[model samples]
Target: MILLEWILFLFLFLGLVFLMGKYMSSVYLGEDTFFTVIGKPLENLIYKTSGINPAEEMNWKQYGLNLVIFNLLGCLVVFLLQVIQGYLPLNPIHAANVHWDLALNTAISFMTNTNWQSYSGESTLTWLVQMLGLTVQNFLSAATGMAAMVAMLRGFTRKETDKIGNFWVDLTRGTVYILIPLSILFSVFLISQGVLQTFHPYQHFYTMENQSQVLPTGPVASQVAIKQLGSNGGGFFGVNSAHPFENPNGLTNIFEMAAILFLPLALVLSFGYMVGNIKQGLAFLISMLVILLLGTGIVWWAEMLGNPLLIKYGIAHGVSMEGVESRFGVLISSFWGLLTTATSNGSVNSMHDSLMPITTLVYMFNMGVGEVVFGGVGVGIIGMLYYALLVMFLAGLMIGRTPEFLGKKLGPREMYLSVIALLVPPILMLIFAAIALMIPSTVGCMNNSSAHGLSELLYAFLSGAGNNGSAFAGLNTNTLYYNFSLGITMFISRFVTILPALAIGGSLAEKKSIPESSATFPTTGILFIAMLIAVVIIMGSLTFFPVFTMGPLLDHLFMIHGKVY
Candidate 1:
C-alpha cells in the first residue's frame, strides 16, 4: 500500500508538471502586454517620481558594474545587521550578536539569491534582523536575479544595441513595480492566515498541553512573500516555514507554496513579452513545469511509502508515515519538498534525510539537473536558458546544421559557455563532498547504507551550494567545514552561472533576430519543448553519472542487500 502511494504520487507530480508546461504555452503565450500591465504604467510612474527615462538603455558594462555595486553594498548591510542584532530593539529573545563568520555566511547566502542559512531561525536571529537584514536581502536578491534575467532576455530581443538595459533602472523597477507590490499583497494574505506580524518578541504563556516551548515570532508575513516570490528560500525560522509561528496553518502553507511559484510562472509570461515571442517564452515555461512536477512526485511518493528499511524492521508500525508531520500531511509536505529544492528554496518540513534512497536521489537530481524549472524567479528562467542553448547546440551538431536559439547563432563561443555553465556545479559538488568525507568533520547515518550516508552529506552541500536550499537533513551541516564549504559553493553556484549567462546575454543582444527559414527549428512548439526536456535529462545523466553511482545509485543497490554493490 505504501509502495502504491509512492507510485501514485510520482505519477501525479509528473502529470502536473507536463500539464502546467503545456498550459503556460497554450493559455498565456504573448497574450498580455507588459507595457500595459507593467511597462508603460511603470514608465509614467518613473518619470513622475524621479524624472528618469524608463525607455532609455544603458551599456552592459554599466549594467554589470551596477549589479556588482548593489550586491556588495547589500552584503555589507546584511553583515552589519547580524553584528548589531543584540542591540536592535525588535529582538524577541534579545538573541546575542551572532559569531562574525556565521553572520558573513548568512549575509552572502541571501545576497546571491543563495539563501543558504547557517543558523536556526527562532534561537539565533532577532526579529529586527530577520526583517531588516535577511528578509530584506530576500527581496533585493530576488529582484537582482529578475533584473539579470530581464537583461538577458533584452539581449536576444534587441538588435545592434550595446545596451542590455540599465541596472539601476531595472533594479528599481523590479522592486517598485513588480516584487514589492506582489510581496505586500501576499504578505497581507499570510498575516490573515494566522502567520504572525509583530514588533514584539514572542509572547510566552503556560500551555494546557503541558510542554515547554518558545513560541516563535517574527515579521514573517513580509519575509514570507519574497522568500517565495524571490525564490530565495531563506526561512524565517530554522526549520523554515515548518516552525509553527512562521507558517502556522494549511492556508498559509498553500499561500507560501503559491508565493514560491507565482512569480516564476508569471515571469514566463514576462519573458515572452520581452522577446516579443509568446511561443519562445511558452516553450521555456512548459519545460520548467514539467521538471518541477517530476521532482514533486518523487518526494510525495517517497514520503508516503514511509521508509522501506523502517517498514522492514517494523520500527514504524502505523498505517501512515511517522517521520512526517501530521499537520502538513504527506501530500503537502511532499509538494513543498519538491518545490523548495527544484526552485532553489531549501527549507524542508518533513526531513529529507529520513526519506528512502530512491526518494533521496530524486531530490538531489533536481539540483543536479541545473535547477532551472521555475527556478529562483530570475535565476531559474536564465539558468534553464543556458541548458536550452546547450541542447540546441548538440542537436545542431547531430543534424549537421548551425544551431540557433531565438535567431542568434550559437557558435563555438556560445556553446562552450553553455557547456561550462552546465558542467561546473557537479564538478564542484563532487570535489566538495570528497573533501568533507576525507575529513572527519562530516559524518552520515550509521546504520543506513554507506552509499546512502554519503548521499545524505552530498545532498546537503549539493542542495545548499547548488542554490537549491532543500537538504537531505540527516547530515549535520552547521560545522565550520559546512559553514565555509557550502558557503563557497553557493557563491560559485551563483556567479559562475550568472557570469556565463550575462556574457551570453551580451552576445545574444549583439545578433539580429533571424526570421524563420527552411533550417529554422521552432523553439515554441511541442517538438522543441520535448527536445529541451531530453536535453536537460541527458546533460544531467552524462555529467553526474560517476558521482551518482557512488551515491544514490549504490545506495539503492545496497538497500536491496546489505553488502556494497
Candidate 2:
C-alpha cells in the first residue's frame, strides 16, 4: 500500500508538472494562458498604480539593484510591523511586539525566502502582522526567486544581448499571474479538506478529564496554500504542518507534499520549453528525481527499521513511528521529511530530530548539497544548472577538449563565478558550524550531547545557509547568539549565491552561440545526467564528510553498539 501511494504520487506530480511547465512558459513569453483574461488586467493595474513601465528591460546590474532595494524595503516594513505588532489592529489574542533582534532576524528571513522562525507563530505574532507582514513577504520573496531564475534562464536562451529581462516585470507577472491564482485555488481546496480559514478567536474546549484546551485558529488555509505552493514554508501555526488544523488528513498531507514539489518540478520543464529543448529539461529533472528517490528510499528504510535500542528493550514495535503524527504514519512522514528538505521547503509534518540517525544523515545530505535536488522553486533549477556548467567544465578537461554548454563556451569569467557560487553554502555552513561549536554560548544551546548535538548545530547552519528552513528541531536557536548569526548566514547565502548566478547569466547573454560541431558536448543524455549527479554528490560529500562523521554517521554507528546519543 505504501509503495502504491508513492508510485501514484510520483506519477501525478510528473504529469501535472509537465503541463504546468508549458503553461508557465506561455506566461513568460507573453503568450495567452488560461488565466490570461484575469491575469493581464491585474498585472496592468499593478504596473500603472506602481508607476512601472512593463516594456522597459534591465541589464544585470540594474536588475540586481532593483531586487536589492525592493527586498530592503520589504525588510524594513516587516521589521516595523513586528516591533509594533502589539499596538496593531486585529490582535484578538493580543500578542506582544517582537524584540528588535528577533524582529530584524525575521524580516531578513522572510525577505530572503528563508522562513526560519526564531519564535513560535501563534504566541508571537498578531493576526494583523501574520497577514500584512509575514504572509505578504511569502508571495514577494517567492516571486523574487522565480524572477531571478527566469532572468538566469533568459541569459541562456538569448544571444548577443546585454539585457536579461526586466526584474520588475518578471516579479509582477510571477506574483499576479502565477502565485495568486494558484494560492486561491489551493486555499479553497484546503478548506474543503478541513484546513482552517477563519479569523475567529481561539476556541476553548474540555476533555473528559476536565482538562482545559485552547484550539488556535486563524486564516491558516490561505497562508498554507502559498507556503507550500511557493516553497515559502512559513507555517501559520508554530508546530507547522504537523498541527492538525494545518495538515488535517492523509489527503491534505499528500496535497501539501505535492504542492511543495510542484513549482520546482514545473520550472524544470519550463527550462526545456524556454530553451526550445524539452529533453534538456528532462535530463535535469531526471537527475533531480534520481537523487530525491534515493534519498527518500534511505529515509523510509531507516525509519521503518526502528531503533535498535528500543527493540533490544523489548518495545517490540514493527517500525519506529516516534515523533511522527499518527495519521500520516512512518511512510508519509519519511517522504515529507525528504521532500521538504530536498526542495528546501522546511515545513514539516514530523519532527526531524526524532528520525533514526541514518535518516537524519540523508536529510543533512539533501540540504548540504544546496538543495539543488529539485531545490526551492526557482533557485533549485538554476542552481543545478550552475552545477551542470561546472560539471561540463570538469568533463571537458577529462576528455581533453575546450568546454562549452548550450553553445556558449565556458570561459574564465563564467567558470570563476560558477565555482564561487558552488562554494558559498558549504563554506558558510562549515565556518559558522565550527564557530558555533567553539563558542560556549552557542554550544550551550545544544539539546543533546556529543554527536546528536553536533548534528543539531550543523543542521541549523546548513538549513539557514541553504535557505532551507528545516531544522533538526532539537537545537534551541532563540538565543541572541544563534538568531543573529543564523540571520546573517541566511542573508548572505540567499543573495551571494543568486547574484553570482545572475551575473553569469548576464555574461553568457552577451556571448554569441557557437554552432554545434562534432566536438560539441551533448547535455541532454544519460551521460550528462550521470556526470551531473556525481558532481553534485561528490562536491557535497567532499566538503562535509568530516561534519557528517561527527554527527549522524557517528550517531548511527554508536546506536548499533547500543550507545545511542
Candidate 3:
C-alpha cells in the first residue's frame, strides 16, 4: 500500500508537469495563452503604470543589471520593514523589530529565492510584514529566477542577436500569469485542507490537562501556498510544515510535496518546448527524476533501519520515529526531506536532526550537488544546463570535435563560465564551514559534539550556499556570527553563479549556431541521460565525498557501534 501511494504520487506529479509545462512555454514564448485574456491586460497595466516598455529587450548584461537592482531594492524594503516592524500596523501580538543581522540575512535569503529563515515567522513578524515584506518578495524573487532562466534559454534558441528578452516583461508575465494564479488556487486548496488563514492574534486556551496553550494563527495559508509554489520554504511557524496549522493532514503533505517539485519539473518540460525539442528536455527531466527517486529511496531505507542503540536496549521498535510526525510517519517524512532538499524547497515535516545519519547525508548530498535534482523553479533548469554544457564539452574532446548543444558551439568563454557556476557553491560551502569550525564561538553553536556536530555546521553552510533553506534543526543559527557568515555565503553563492550564467548566455547569443551533422552527439537518448547522471555524480562526489567521510559517514559507522553523538 505504501509503495502504491508513491507510484500514484509520481503519476499525478508527472501529469501536472506535462500540462503546466506546455502552458508555461506558451506564456513565456509570447504566444496567446488562455491566461492571456486576463493576464495580458494586467501585464499591460503594470507596464503602463510603472513606465516599462515591454517590447524593449535587453542584452545579457542589461538584463542582469536590472535584475540585480530590482532585487537589491526589494531587499532594502524587506530589511527596513523588519527593523521597524514593531512600528508597523497589524501587529496583533506586538512583535518587535528584528535584529539587524538576522534581518539582513533574511532579506538576502528571500531576495535570492533562498528563503533561509534565521527567525521564525509567526513570532518574529507581524501580519503586515508577512504579507508586505516576505510574501511580496516570494513572488518577485521567484519571478526573478524564472526571468533569468527564460533569458538564458533565449541565448540558446536565438543566434547573432544581442537582445534576449526584456527583464521587466518576463518578470511581469511570470508573476502575473504563472505565480499569482497558481498561488491563488493552491491557497484555496490549502484553506480547504484546514491550513489556517486569519488576522486573529494568538489564542489562549486550557487543554484537557488544564495546562494553558497558545495557538498561533495568522495568514498562514496564503504564505504556505507560495512558499511551496515559489520554492520559498520559510515557514510561518518555527516548526515549519511540521506544525499542524501549516500542514494539517496526510493529503496536505502529499500535495505540498508535489507542489515543491511542480514548477521545477514543469520548467524542465518548458525548456524542451522553448528550445524546440521535447526529447532534449525529457533527457534532463529523467536525469533529475532518477536522482530524486534514488535519494528518496536511500532516505527511506536509512530511516527504516532505525537506531542501533535503541534496538540494542530494547526500549522501542526498530523504526526511527524520534522526531517524525505520527500523521506522516517514516515513508512520507523521508520522502519530504529528500524532496525539499532536492528542489531547494526547504520546508520540513519532521526534525532532520533526528533522522538517521545516512539519511542526513542523503539530504546534504542533494544540496551539495547544487540542488540540480529538480532544483528551484527557474534556477534548477539553468543549473542543469550548465552541466549539459560541460557534458557536451567532454563528449567533444573524446570525439575530437567542437562540442555543440542545441546547435551552439561550446567555446572557451562558455566553458569557463560554466565551470565557475558549477564550482562556486561547493567551494564556498567547504571554505566557510571550515572557517566556522575553527572559531570557538562558532563551534559553540553546535547542539551535538563529534561527527554529528560537524554535520550540523556543514549542513548550515550547504543550505546557504546551495540556496537551500532547510537546517539540521540542532544548530543555533540565530547568533550574530552565523547570521553574518551564512548571509555572506548566500549572497556570493547566488550571484557568483548567476552572473556567470548570464555572461555565458550573452556569449552564446553572439555566436552563429552550427548545423547538426553526422558527428554531432545526440542529447536525447539513454546514453546522454547516463552520461549526464554520471557527470552530476562525479562532480558532486569529487567535491563533497571527503567531507561526507568525516561527517555523516563517520556518524553512521559510530551509530552501528552503538555510539550516539
By lDDT, the best candidate is 3
Superior candidate under lDDT, 2 versus 3: 3
> In candidate 2, where is summed lDDT lowest over 10 consecutive residues?
312-321
> Which stretches of candidate 2 lie above 4 Å from their native place?
1-9
lDDT of 1 at 454: 76
For model 1, what is the error of residue 182's alpha carbon versus the real structure, in angstroms, after optimal superposition?
1.5
Off by over 4 Å in 3: 1-6, 313-316
Q: What order do candidates take by TM-score, descending? A: 3, 2, 1
Judged by whole-model lDDT over C-alpha atoms, candidate 2 comes out at 0.88
Q: For each candidate, what is the lDDT?
A: 0.73, 0.88, 0.90
- Give residue 544's lDDT in candidate 3 (0 to 100): 93
Better of 1 and 2 by TM-score: 2
Candidate 2 per-residue C-alpha lDDT over 438-481 given as tens digits, one digit per residue, 9 for 90 to 100: 88988888888888888889889988988988877878898887
lDDT of 2 at 66: 94
Please give the distance, in angstroms, between residue 183's alpha carbon in candidate 2 and its true position after superposition.
Answer: 0.7
- What is the Cα-based TM-score of model 3? 0.98
- Give per-residue CA lDDT, model 1, range 1-565, as digits (tens): 9779657855664455444333333222223333236544664676678666656767766677778787888989988998888987877686999887788788878888878766778789887788778888887888788788877777787777777877666666667656777778888888887878876667677778976666766677788777877888877877777777667787677667766766776676667766677777778878877877677676566556554455556656322344466788766776777777777776676666655566667777778886777777778888788888877877787888899888788778787877787778888877888898888646632224478777877787777656877765556677777878887887787777776777777877888777879778777889888988988888777877787788887876775564542
